[model samples]
Target: MSCTTAHAHELYQLYASHLIKRDIWDVKRSVMEQRFQFDPFAPQISCAGIHEHHKILDDLGDEMVVINQAYTRLWPAAQRDCTYLTSRRRVDDTDIYAVINYSVNHPDDHIPASFVRASAEVGMVCESVIRPQCTETSLDALTRQDIQTKIYYQAKISPGGWVPAAVVRETSKREYPKFLHQLGKGCTEHFSDRPLDCSTVKKAFESRPPPAE
Candidate 1:
């Protein structure tokens, strides 16, 4: 997706916000409810050493662990815990932003007997590149309209229970692009006027204690 009125960093922040604020930003159609088993943005650590290696020591970014109750029209409601990593980087004249989420079993997470356990692995990347047509000499003069964003998304999911893996994969192939489109739309609307305030999230990760050895 390309934005005419948002820069790369601005777009990146908005994208990251949707993931970090999952309880607020997740699509209701996909996730019925979400709760953080381990909030990467919380001020206090929930687990002593669970996420020690998931830290953002460089520009790779923050990580999170969450439990979500999700559903689809073809399958019953299912529950899963996932680990997510979100990051941003600059290569040459382009800015690359990415999010990776995969199913993980946490010792602290307990699944209800009524809920089927599901598994998913998803990867999304957005690249914001400066338009070649732009010839602005001053950095301050560069406008948001000068950047174009390209998005790539991939997912593999098994809804568990009676859902076939092939059916799930086929459904994802058809649906994930729509999901990305919605994400881009949300990002554009969210930062229509100003960029997101990411300091709070950044601080939380920065201040977190190292994972236990």
Candidate 2:
């Protein structure tokens, strides 16, 4: 299942539109603003490598697009929420991200602590299960030669972490201007273009229904 760059962007746009129609951005933005307490329009915001409010929304939208697009290219038998957001870091250099949570599909399947990191980041996202070493049996040790060979093989075929760069560029060209317009309009009307504290947003959402799938 190989997905072309064009198809991936199209899939992203479709899901992204669904999310916007449902006011997903508003829901997230309300909470995010409250938590971060940063002004989106401040020049200092850009200097910190943090995207302003609109860009954050676009990134989330972009991530959804990538996940769904990647799904179309995955083996049909592969069944799991491909979308994950990292949440915690453990002492062993293994980080934990949401295995699945807070989505309409697969409701009640909020399994955490499933995904584990084996080593440092590779340029691509790939997973393979390794059996735990047992005290009773000594495992054969391999040096740099063996590890290098494995890395070469895996990286050669991996998708290089996300959708192709060309797809991202094209998607932005088509979608970003409209997104920016909407964000500006929305902020002006609702927030007066100010960033809010997360506590307010969190309480507000506490009463509303959970975000859509």
Candidate 3:
């Protein structure tokens, strides 16, 4: 049989098992071509193909594992205390929320305010099976005017009761490196038949751990 668009959906396994499992979302993935042949898990980015493409995981048991793994790798980290300033919701009932933290360029200089904007877009996420109401979420708009930093919406996701997940920095003993390492391993040994998106890894922000004591 011809291997052209003729294979089962199989991912790189390494990306989700390590590196990108957690950092995938924040990372800015390049425009990935749809994996139509030889792989079933590839997404349909075009308007017409979107609805049908998103339904890749509807009833298939094998594909469900792929979506679940994607979900875990995509969740943001917990809030921190010492460096953390505050956390609040942007809107009611919606999965969108914002977390603010204090940081500085140098010790002498006062820490500038940093905020993380998060939301599950609702209709944009690609699935083996399409959900009724869904939109992809992504880093829609990131604005920085002098000191102001605003990250608008991007791709959407299912609102799986997603809330503001947080952990205070100073209070939290775990360091950034430690967290990054763990974050990379979002799915552990859970394997999937999905190709790895290099764009996703390239676009991720640099993870910085706190200074050594």
lDDT scores for all predictions? 0.42, 0.24, 0.23
Writing each residue's lDDT as its tens digit, candidate 1 over 1-213 gives 332222334533554443332321121122322321211111110111121111121122233323333322222334333333333333333345566656665554555565565555556676665555655444445466645568776544444444333333344445445546667788777767875333212322334344344
- lDDT minimum window of 10 residues, candidate 2: 148-157
Ranking by lDDT: 1, 2, 3
Q: What lDDT does model 2 reach?
A: 0.24
How does model 3 fare in lDDT? 0.23
Model 3: per-residue lDDT, tens digit, 1-213? 221111212332322233232222221123222311111211111111111111112122322111222122122533211111111223333323342212212232221233222222211111111122223222222111101112232222212222222222121233324433442344332423444332222222122222244
TM-score of 2: 0.21
lDDT of 2 by residue, 1-213 (tens): 234445444433432332333211111111133232221211110011111111111123222311311111133222122232211111132221111112122232332343211111112121111222212121133221111101110101112222233333334344434544553354335534444333322222334343344
Q: Pick the candidate with the highest lDDT.
A: 1
Clash pairs for candidate 1: 49-212, 52-211
TM of each candidate vs. truth: 0.51, 0.21, 0.18
Candidate 2 vs candidate 3, TM-score winner? 2
lDDT of 1 at 174: 51
